[model samples]
Target: MAHVDPSAPLEGKASKETERKLKRESRTQIVSFVFMVFITTTAFLTVASDVIPSGFAIPFILLLASVQVIMQLYYFMHMNAKGTGWVNALIWGGLFVAAMTVAALMLLIGITKY
Candidate 1:
């Protein structure tokens, strides 16, 4: 058995847990970045193809983008893992109001006839 020295710093078990959390965080960020890149590239291709013209597709794309952004913010941003209920509730409330406002305008304005 090796002798322990009080003067020297010793390795603590917390280091392993800290490292694991860091790795998980790094992985989450990388995955989020990859997903963002994929979404952006797909958006770019859709815009370039013009098969789904911006006039017809922009709103749909915007909705998907909002979802993806929320996913990243909630996950990789650690909002879901660390935030209080009030914080999350506030975010959801904002999203709901934004959606409701957009829906009201679109419906009231008769923007989508098709």
Candidate 2:
């Protein structure tokens, strides 16, 4: 058998691939963070100012909040990474159930009659 080098530099193809992957992840995280901040500021301004009506602002802010939650889950929680298939399935299923429950409640409350 041949002796192995103990002090070899980690500069092979695998290292390069990992470096590129890290760079791409960093860029995506930065972009997502900026988007989250923008959404938050927009929501705050919408509520602080009288430009948008309350009825429109509420729904708009809710939509933005949901988008922000999705971003947080995918980026911060790494839900899009490998080996997270089951986690994704569970989270999405929970969301579906919650949405259905809310829809049922809304229907019972006669929201469409307004």
**Candidate 1: stretches off by over 4 Å:** 1-14, 52-60, 105-114
Worst 10 residues of 2 by lDDT: 8-17
User: What TM-score number comes out for model 1?
Assistant: 0.65
Residues 6-106, candidate 2: write the lDDT tens digits. 78875646578889998998999999999999999999999999878999999999999999999999998999899999999999999999999999988
Q: RMSD of model 2, in Å?
A: 6.6
Q: RMSD per prediction, one decimal?
A: 8.5, 6.6
Clashing residue pairs for model 2: none
Residue-level lDDT tens digits of model 1 in 1-114 = 387787888665668888999898889888888888888787777778847867867886786688688878687666787546887888789989998999899997896764
Candidate 2, residue 14: the lDDT equals: 55
Clashes of each: 0, 0
Strongest candidate by lDDT: 2
